[model samples]
Target chain A: AQSVTQLDSQVPVFEEAPVELRCNYSSSVSVYLFWYVQYPNQGLQLLLKYLSGSTLVKGINGFEAEFNKSQTSFHLRKPSVHISDTAEYFCAVRMRSKAAGNKLTFGGGTRVLVKP
Target chain B: GAGVSQSPSNKVTEKGKDVELRCDPISGHTALYWYRQSLGQGLEFLIYFQGNSAPDKSGLPSDRFSAERTGGSVSTLTIQRTQQEDSAVYLCASSLDRGSSGNTIYFGEGSWLTVV
Candidate 1:
């Protein structure tokens, strides 16, 4: 009952280029991946998280993500981007157990227009 | 309140009047969440508190939407009647006790209901 698919709603990069923001998830069991960043009015802010072991999960400003268990995906990169890294990105999922609670399941966002 | 703290950030209400949004978590952080962001659409899973247990409303979207997390950190989301699609932007998050191992879920800069 977990779902998160953010293929891209808007992504216009330029300054410094290099940006990827795609995510997918359907979850039937293990899950816990996140990458949030909303800066217009400001709220969300955790840039990276992938729960278990490494799957390439950086975070903070440099940003990074790469937990692809067979293809459930969890993309969100940023080799270089500036213009203050225009924001509005999200992709979440949570269900690593705990009786399937902790609620998160998000993804319908991906607006990173860093121009200039 | 060094982080997750929301409250009348911006409310307009009038559709039927009955809004009450407020959250204050981060002191002890025991997991508390409630989301709903609609303007562009994303984060919408409203209800979850993990401390005293017994919350997880399963993503409430009806029953007039209600929430409560009292003696364990402070949370109050009530919307009864107010329609207009219930406006939008009403996020509040917290974590550190949801199967804690690194549970990170801090957010709050929301609360902009405008049910005019």
Candidate 2:
């Protein structure tokens, strides 16, 4: 079985400030990583994904994440956040095997409150 | 639709009553998944389907929860005798085929269930 842990439950940041949300996973086999964001009252939207190659992957809304295999971590980062960035972020992982299918294990989620 | 569609964006039901949530995955998507999100539990995988066949059902929280997919497109999650603890947002997603390269799972807006 695979599991994910998001170290921070909530993070408060000021507008135009940098922010990072940490995520770690435990799995016996290789897996794919993903980051998603859910705005207030909206559905989750994919921020980015890390399947293979280029440990550093970028996504929409100027968000990026680095996949550190040795550390078993996939941390999401944004150089500058806006008021619109205030949302809940989730980290997820899926098994690499076809037999494992498309089931994803998600972390507890980190709520970001970007203030002006 | 351009993305996954879920019905009854919000539902309120009495405890012990049964409720059904529907999901319509993206066209041509062979893999579909169900996830639960709550204030206490965060995000958790429930079930998934591969072309109308469910390979795993253990992720469901209890026997009261059941899901079925027909025609490999629409899926319905049935919660029998719902409890207050079962109140949460149910999210549905769909991917291309497997956990292969460039495969991304798209999510629906989710059906919000409130059991009182």
Candidate 3:
């Protein structure tokens, strides 16, 4: 079974400050990673994903994440944040191949609060 | 292009009653998924439907929960004998058929269900 763990439950940062949300996974098989953001009272939107190729993957809203195979982590980062960036973030994983069911396993989300 | 859409944005039901949530995927999307999000909690995978094939129901919490996708476009998730624990925001997502070629999933606004 694939499991994702988000180390922080809440992160508070001032506007324009750099921020990072840490995520780690435990899975024996190859996996695909994703980061999703949910605005207050809104649905989730994809931030970025890491399937293969470059370990450093850039996403929308000036966010990016690095996939560290040795560390088994995919940490999301943004150079600067805005008040609008306040939201809940989730990290998810899915098996890499068709032989395995491509079902997503999500982590307990980390809530980000950006203050002005 | 329109993203995934869900119906009855908010629903309130009594315990022991049955409730159904509907999801309409994006045009041409062949993969649909159902998930649940509780207050201050992470998203929980509920089910997966690919085209017209039998859905992968492994994430469903119990037999009372079931889902079906018709015509490979719209899906309905039914929870029988709804309990207080069943109250949550039910989310729907869809993705293009990539056959493991790295497709991103788009989500709906979700239907908030409250059981009294």
Top candidate, metric TM-score: 3
State the DockQ, from 0 to 1, for candidate 1. Answer: 0.29
Question: Which stretches of candidate 3 lie above 4 Å from their native place?
Answer: none
lDDT of 3 by residue, B1-116 (tens): 48898988999999999999999999999999999999766688899988777888888999999998887888999999999999899999998867783688889999999999
Best by DockQ: 3
lDDT of each: 0.87, 0.91, 0.92
TM-score sort, best first: 3, 2, 1
lDDT of 1 at A21: 91
Docking class of 1: acceptable
Question: lDDT per residue, candidate 2, B1-116, as tens digits?
Answer: 99999999999999999999999999999988899999888888899787646457868999999999987789999999999999899999988984372488899999999999
Q: What is the DockQ of each candidate?
A: 0.29, 0.66, 0.71
lDDT of 2 at A60: 99
**Superposition error at B37 for model 2 (Å):** 0.6
Can you write out model 1's per-residue Cα lDDT over A1-116, one digit (the tens) per residue? 87898988999989998999999999888888988899999899888898989899998889889998999898989899999989889888888777656677788898889988
Give the per-residue lDDT digits (tens) of candidate 1, residues B1-116. 58988998999979987989999988988888888999766678888888886887977989988999889999999998898988999999888874453488899999899887
- Best of the candidates, lDDT: 3
Once superposed on the true structure, which residue ranges of model 1 sit more than 4 Å away at CA?
A1-14, A17-30, A34-54, A57-75, A80-87, A105-113, B1-14, B17-35, B38-44, B47-63, B66-80, B83-85, B89-114
Model 2 spans with C-alpha error above 4 angstroms: B98-102
